[model samples]
Target: MRTLAAFFLCVCALPLWAQEDAGALAREAGAQLEAASVRLAEAESARNRVRALTDTVHAYEAGLSAMRAGLRRAAIREAQLRAQLQARDAEIAQLVAVLQTLTPDEAPTAFLHPDGPNGTARAGMLLAELTPALNQRAAQLRKDLSDVESLRLLQEQAAAQLQTGLTEVQTARSALNQAMAERTDLPQRFSEDPVRTAILIASAETLDAFSSGLASIVEGDVGWTPPEVDDLIGEFPMPARGVILRRAGEPDAAGIARPGILLATRPGTLVSAPTAATLRYVGPLLDFGTVTILEPRPGTLIVLAGMAVSYGKTGQIIAASTPLGLMGGLPASNGPSTGGEGGGAERSETLYIEVRENNVPMDPLEWFSTEQDG
Candidate 1:
C-alpha cells in the first residue's frame, strides 16, 4: 500500500516541478521582451541607430522564440497531466472507496480482527498510517489539477506577449532598413563597377564561371587583405537564426541535391555576416535570388543566396554579424504561430549556403559548428 502511494506521489511531484519550469521559461521570454524594449528606446538617440535597432530586433526574435517554446512545453505538460488523471480515474475511485471503509463510523468493525485485541490494535495503527497517505494523495490531485488550470491560463495570456514581440520586431526591421539606406560610413575595398559585373554575368553561362569572374569585375589595388580565418573555420556562427532544413548533397522533395546547406528562417528575420569578409559580388546571379558572395580569405568564397533583400555593394568589406539583409517573407501575424519553433519549410523561408575554395564547391556544414546547428 505504501509503495503504491509512493508511485502516485512520484507522478504528482514531477509535474508540479515541470509546471514551475514552464513558468520560468515564460518569464525568460518576458525578460527578453524587456531587453528589446530597452534597445528600441536606445536606438532613438544612438549614434549607431542601425546597430541598436538590429540588436532590438534580435532581442524581439529571441523573446518570441522563447515564448513559443514555453507555451509549447506548457501545452505538452498539461496534456500529460490530463492523460495521467484520466488514466488514474479507476484507481482513484478504488482509493476513495477504501478510504470510506476506514471512516470513523466504520473503523470499529475494521479494527476487529480474528486474533483478538493485539491484532485489533495493529490493524488500527495500519489504518491510521494508510489514511494519511490517502489524504496526501488527494491533496496532490488537487494541486495537479490547479497546475493544469494555471498552464492553460499561461498560454492564453501569452497571446498578448507574442503579438507584442511580433510587432516590435517588425518595427525594428523597418527602422533598420531606413537607417541602412541613409547611412554612409561603411568601408569599401573597391568601387563597384556595375558595367563590368553585368558584362561578366552576361558572358558566363554557369554559376562557377560567374563566380570566377566576380573578383575581376571589381579589380582594384587593394593593399589590405582580410586576415585568415582558418582557425575559426568550424566555429563560425550561422548567418541567421534558423534551423537547417537540408545539408549539402541532401536530396530534396524532387530528389535533387545541391552542394550547400539550406536554413529555414522566419519571415523578415535578419541575416548577418558570419565573419568579416569582402563582398566580392552582391545581387542576383543565375537562379539564386538575391545573393552575397564574400571572400573571407584568399582563394575562399562563401556564397549566401535566397534572401528577399540582400545588403552591401560589391567590393565592400563588412564586419562579423553585420546585417546582410532580411529573409524573404511577410511579417508574422499577431497571433500564435503554426511553426513549431523553426522546424519546417512551410513555416519558414530558406537560406542557401555554399562554400568554395579555388572555385570548387565544398560542403557548408564542414565550415559551421555542428554541435550548435539544429
Candidate 2:
C-alpha cells in the first residue's frame, strides 16, 4: 500500500509540476506594467529624455511580454487539467460509486474476503488503509478541478491586461519617437553626400563594395571622439529581443551562409544600438531592405539591416541602447506576437547583425551579449 501510494503521488506530481502558479505570474505581469508606467512618468523630467523614454519603452515591452507568457501558460494549463478530468470521468464515477457503497458501518464487511477468518483479518486491514488513500485521491480531484477553474478565470481576465499594456506601450513608443526627433544633445559626425552616395550605390556591385567605398561618400570629416568599447568585448548589448535564427556562418534553409547572425523578432520590435557609435550609412543596399552601418571605433563597424522604419540619418552620433529603428512588421502596440518564431509571418521579420574589424568579417556572436536586455 505504501509503495502504491508513492507511485500515485509520483504520477500526480507530473501534472502538478507542469502547472505554474498562474496567479503569481499574473501578479508579476501587473507589477511589470506598473513599473513601466512609473518609468514612463520619470522620462518626462529626466535630463536625458531620449534614454529615459527608451528605457520606459523597453519596460512596457517587457511587461507585455510577461503578460502574454502568463496568459499562454494559463490557457495551456487550464486545457491540460480539463482534458485530464474529462478523460478520467468514467474512472471518477466508478471511484464515487465504490466509495458510496463503502458506508462507515458496513464498509469492512463489504470489503472482507470470503475465504475464512485469516482472509477476513487481512481484508479488514486492507479496508483500514485503503480508506485514507481513496480519501486522498478524492481531495486531489477537487483541487485539480479548482485549479482548472482558476486558470480559466485568469485567462479570461488577461484580455484587459493585454489591452492596457498594448495601449501604454504604444504611448511610450510615440513619446520616444518625439523625444528622438527633438534631441539636440548628441554630437554630429558628418552628413552623408547623397549625390556621391547615389553614384556609389549605382556603381557598387555588392554590400562589401558599398561599405568599402562609404568613406568617399562622406561630405565632411568626423571630429567627434568615438566611445571606446574595450571592456565590452564579451558583454555588448543585444540589438533587440529575439530568438537567434542563425549564428555567424550558419546556413539558412536555402543553404546560403552569411558572416552575420540573424535574429527572429516580433514585428515593430524596437532595435537599438549595441553601443555608442556614429551612423556611417543608413539606406537600402543590395538584397537587404534597409541597412544602418555604425562606426563605434576606428577599425570596427556594426551593421544592422532589415528594419521596417529606421530613426537616425547618416552621420548621427548615437549612444548605447539608443533606438535605431523597428523590425519589419506591426508594432507591439497592436497584438503581441506568439511563440514559435520558426512559424508565423509577423514573427518572421529578422534583424541581421554583422560585426567587422578592419574591413574583415568577424563572428557576430563574439561581439553580442547573450542576455536579452533589448
Q: Which residue pairs in candidate 2 have backbone atoms (N, alpha carbon, C) closer than 3 angstroms, thus clashing? A: none
Per residue, candidate 1 scores C-alpha lDDT tens digits across 1-374 of 34445654654554333435566688678778878988898897998887888788878877877887887887888898899789878867766676666665645565577889897777677767667876877777788888889888888878677766766777677778888888778887887777888898889887789888876776664645787798999888888878889989999999988888998887777888889998888898888878898889888999999998877788788888889998866634423343333334333689999999999999888898755422
Clashes of each: 0, 0
Q: What is the TM-score of each candidate against the true structure?
A: 0.86, 0.84
Q: Report the C-alpha lDDT of model 2 over 1-374, residue by residue, as the tens digit.
A: 34434544544454433445756667688789989988888888998898888888788777777777788777877777888889888767866765664474645566555787787777568667776876777777898889988887777777677677666666666677778778777777888889999999899987778878989888777577876788888788788887788899999899989899998877657889888898999889888889999999987988999997788888888888889987765544433433222134435679999988888999988988887732
Candidate 2 Cα errors over 4 Å, as ranges: 1-23, 105-124, 251-255, 331-346
By summed lDDT, which 10 consecutive residues of candidate 1 come out lowest?
Answer: 334-343
Candidate 2 lDDT at 32 equals 91
State the displacement of the C-alpha of residue 244, model 2, in Å, after optimal TM-score superposition: 1.4
What value does the lDDT take at residue 143 in candidate 2? 87
Off by over 4 Å in 1: 1-20, 100-119, 219-221, 331-346
Model 2's alpha-carbon lDDT is: 0.77
How much lDDT does each candidate structure score? 0.78, 0.77
